[model samples]
Target chain A: MSDTILFDYWRSSASYRVRIVLNLKRIAYRAVPTDLLTRQQKAPDYVARNPQGLVPMLHIDGQDLTQSLAIIDYLDATRPEPRLIPADPVARAATLARAMVIIADIHPVNNLRMLHYLKNEMGQDQAAVDAWYRHWIAEGFAALELMAPENGLFGCDAPDLTDVCLVPQVANARRFELDMAPYPRLTRIDAALQAIPAFAAAHPERVKPA
Target chain B: MSDTILFDYWRSSASYRVRIVLNLKRIAYRAVPTDLLTRQQKAPDYVARNPQGLVPMLHIDGQDLTQSLAIIDYLDATRPEPRLIPADPVARAATLARAMVIIADIHPVNNLRMLHYLKNEMGQDQAAVDAWYRHWIAEGFAALELMAPENGLFGCDAPDLTDVCLVPQVANARRFELDMAPYPRLTRIDAALQAIPAFAAAHPERVKPA
Candidate 1:
């Protein structure tokens, strides 16, 4: 067994993504929390580990993988117990592409750093910032809702990698109280995925810190 | 022969990524420029193809695929001319993780919409806005510089998808006059890749509206 450690913050959706995947794979790992509230992730040591100063840096056999999607893909490829990504090219592309809809297009637009700039530098109040965040989530999810086959269960069948990434990001959206009425397909899919033990058990509340 | 048409804008690094992959694979494609500055991508007809209103959407046999990395990966999978992503699990993860260091983390943070907010809504001037763009690029490239293996070429033994993604973003970095001097590994690799036909041919200048 490889010695694996994950430096994570409890509330980070990015960290939340890895947690869901590890739980699904039943990978036993230690979680060393970085308190995001105190901005400890910005500290020098943490910066050394991840110069990007992000959360959920997975130290696998001393190799530190930074991006959550890359880390999860690595876990999927290495473990392969219950696969996260699909096997087929077109299908896998769809799975990964839908997942990136959240990771690349939507999430970054609302992250803490962007919010910090909006509030501190831009002089926007909390309401405006919240609106900005909700706008992008709604935008991305709307497209995802339409694209979802509605023909398959859990991110278009039986809980794949896209399913793993989607739940946490949607959970973040829920925390922000974003209106989900515009995205019925996503909400329905979210309901289905959360019903499964693998996803539900990895909720932020279930983690040790809480 | 497959009917492949790439809807692109010359200056779009996202489109440029696909262009490089197509050239690397020696695939025949026709470039149909979608002028982004004129709100062409947002037109009802174009939006029908891609709801997100983004470019680098590839039309192959009537199906359109958006998102640069997704398109590139699709090309890599279907045509094995020049493999764009690593086949090894660990190594592939490192390559993708390194690539996402730019695609996921840095690029979106400075996306056109995000920059729009930094200027119009956030009240940041050109200098502050340029600083903001460079800040994330520098932070991201710094990590990538460390991530680039010395013995390995182009973040791996061969030029992979990560390298394809890296070059365009680095070129964008140079546009802002960002000092890439600090990140020698990336600058070195950029030099290496840029000198090649695929890279040189995919130049934004080589695309339309230059």
Candidate 2:
């Protein structure tokens, strides 16, 4: 009860994004793992608590919040320092557009559930499934490489919501073995994000249960 | 430009959502159709302007913007009246979560590009593609029915971002002929949205090219 509890999976890109935000904001949160591999997200109790049956649901201030970006927004709203969304309207819109390139476009298409469907329901082989994953990441990153802030951050001045989304999707790209050579800017931003203490702490390898 | 120009397609659920928001806010915008069927979004000029090659891109206040929700956020931030995001932190979180259920979960899976990939790349038949479309909408709506606000709106006492996302998704549901009996609340809320002038004015049929 003392710490904000995050119901998350270690390898979930969406969960990873929220975890980075929590660490960035210095908000102490208990990590309660929801094992997607085991289909634990579908359990009656879990489904009742979060109807979306998605990981990265947060319980804080006696309220339940779901959706990684929404949770990040809530954290930013409640804890205004280290602002995740930019102050300028144009910059904010640009940052969000960049973030959505990952959140709504890339990650959703290449997520574990979609990959599973591609393999099982669609009868795609490992190679085909892997191709599907890399294709999306590559397509998304192609655009993001152009749109990312030129100041070496994904957003202006500092790592904003776009950076939070970028690193996780980059991790997914590496996991799927997509060629990173094409997206130099995204790779540079991801490298920068990895150096940040908050992002380093939230790495899936660090959060993965032994 | 005499008015803000929205690069859009009549049948695009994303553009429809933004159109509803513009109407709700009483903002006048000129709709410049981007023919997705002809792959106009991928042409060199269009891709140069919007690297993502997605529609509902807005040219406003001497700035070019992409992504529907991001554009809506930009509108809300600049206009500040009849806010799309709620004032209360918790309420805003809830609203955004519901919106993501559509934006991230449902819409992305059913978008035209995904359907094209399923058919052309994966050799999915019309029936298979239809089943895929219906599967995602049903799964998402099952949860949204529970998470949606009880006052017959998707957010505090009125339609907020969640409703903006919902109505268009429901329009998609109808277009795909998904059974509506399962989500009574969503149907009721959609019915409410249809009565509002803003939502009605943005219907695909009205905006379709003659």
Per-residue lDDT of candidate 2, residues B1-210 (tens digit)? 356999989999999999998998988888899999999989899899899998989999999999998999999999977888987888788888889999999898888988988888888899988988998899999999998666667655667898899889998999889999998889999998899898999999989999
Q: Kindly list the per-residue Cα lDDT of model 2 for residues A155-199, writing each as its tens digit.
A: 555788989998888888898788899888788888988999999
Per-candidate DockQ vs. reference: 0.62, 0.86
Q: Provide the lDDT at A48 for model 2.
A: 94
- Tell me the tens digit of each residue's lDDT in model 1 across A91-206: 67767777888999888778888788777765788988988888778878877876776655544557887678788889889988988888777788888888988788788888
Give per-residue CA lDDT, model 1, range B84-203, as digits (tens): 787787778777877888888888888777777667865779988898888888878887887776755564556887788888999889999999889888877888888889889999
Q: In model 2, where do residues sit more than 4 Å from their true spots?
A: none
Identify the candidate with maximal TM-score: 2
Chain A TM-score of model 2 comes to 0.97
Give the DockQ-based CAPRI class for model 2. Answer: high
Instruction: Give the i-RMS of model 1 in Å.
Output: 1.8
Off by over 4 Å in 1: A42-48, A151-154, A208-210, B150-152
Give each candidate's fraction of reference contacts reproduced: 0.62, 0.86
